[model samples]
Target chain A: DQQVKQNSPSLSVQEGRISILNCDYTNSMFDYFLWYKKYPAEGPTFLISISSIKDKNEDGRFTVFLNKSAKHLSLHIVPSQPGDSAVYFCAAQLKYNFNKFYFGSGTKLNVKP
Target chain B: DVKVTQSSRYLVKRTGEKVFLECVQDMDHENMFWYRQDPGLGLRLIYFSYDVKMKEKGDIPEGYSVSREKKERFSLILESASTNQTSMYLCASSPGGGFNEKLFFGSGTQLSVL
Candidate 1:
């Protein structure tokens, strides 16, 4: 079973537009959520994360919104740039400690210039 | 900054042969993990080691084993290569075992088994 699911396999957006990617989880115990970005041949890299205690976390042009009641999270990039094109994965952390992470299939985002 | 380095970016192996994939980290992370990435399956963990010589099987450890002799090194072993094992193998390291710790990944090793 997929504890975390990104439903959307791919998404495309125009430059300078808002690009939103969504993720959902079934496990309520997952308190910490993280986002990673991967290029075609590169490994994933940390993007942003949020704790269950907070509803939203923002860094620069990226913002992650957490809906605990809905068990859903979304990443928003304002003014999406062509360079932002990559596969985005959402992962969840069960315990506050230890590196047990569950990942989603990933959403491929394409930004058109 | 944490840096994870995989020994190979691309490899080709013959069926029934043995394969060893190596990973090294410069951050002295205590936790290291191995995962395979395939289309539709995403990234599934193969094995992980919290400390030297300690290993735990992850979701997909059927055809793989792991060895950790030093704090900075982790190795994934494929006892008998098979066509099904051809995929991108990724190695990651975290400062600690806590899920809160950010993971640093190597470039990845793409293996092709014939």
Candidate 2:
């Protein structure tokens, strides 16, 4: 069973608009969530992360909101640029198992200019 | 920057043949991982090592094995390659085995089995 799920396979947005991606997890033990961005033929890179203790975490144009009650998290990019087009993956780690991570299928984001 | 380098970007192997995929990291990280990326399946961990000569199985380690004789190096071994094993293999490294540590990944190695 997939502990983490990104239901949206793809998303499209216009440049300078707000792009939002959503993710849900089934494991209540997961205390940390992370977002990774990947381009074609390239490995994924860390984007942003949030801890269960915090409701929101922001870095520059990126913001991650966590709702522990719903077991959901979302990533928002303000003024989305064409360069931001890539596959976004949401991953979660169990609080006790630090070495193992569970990843979602990923959503392909297309920011149109 | 943390540079995790895979020895090969692409490889073609015959079924039943033994295959070895090598990975090296510039950072002196204590944790290394092997994962396979497939459409719909996302990235599934095959194996990981916390330190030299130490290894552990991940979610999908049925036909795969890993070796970590050195701290900076981790190798994934396919004892008997099969067509089903064809996929993008990724190697990653982290400073420590912690939920807070963000992973650094290699570009990836696409292995094709005939």
Clashes of each: 5, 0
Give one digit per residue, the lDDT tens place, for model 2 in A1-113.
88899999999999999999999999999989999999988889999999999999999999999999999999999989999999999999889988888999999999999
DockQ of 1: 0.71
iRMSD of all candidate structures: 1.4, 1.1
- Chain A TM-score for each of the predictions: 0.97, 0.99
CAPRI grade of model 1? medium
TM-score, cand. 2 vs. native = 0.98
Question: How would you encode candidate 1's per-residue C-alpha lDDT over B1-114 as one tens digit per residue?
Answer: 789999999999999999999999998889999999988777888999999999898988998999999999999999999999999999999988455677889999999999
Best by TM-score: 2
Residue pairs with clashing backbones, model 2 = none
User: Best-fitting candidate, measured by lDDT?
Assistant: 2
Q: Mind giving the per-residue lDDT tens digits that candidate 2 earns over B19-61? A: 9999999989999999999998899999999999999999999
iRMS of candidate 1, one decimal? 1.4
lDDT, candidates in the order shown: 0.93, 0.95
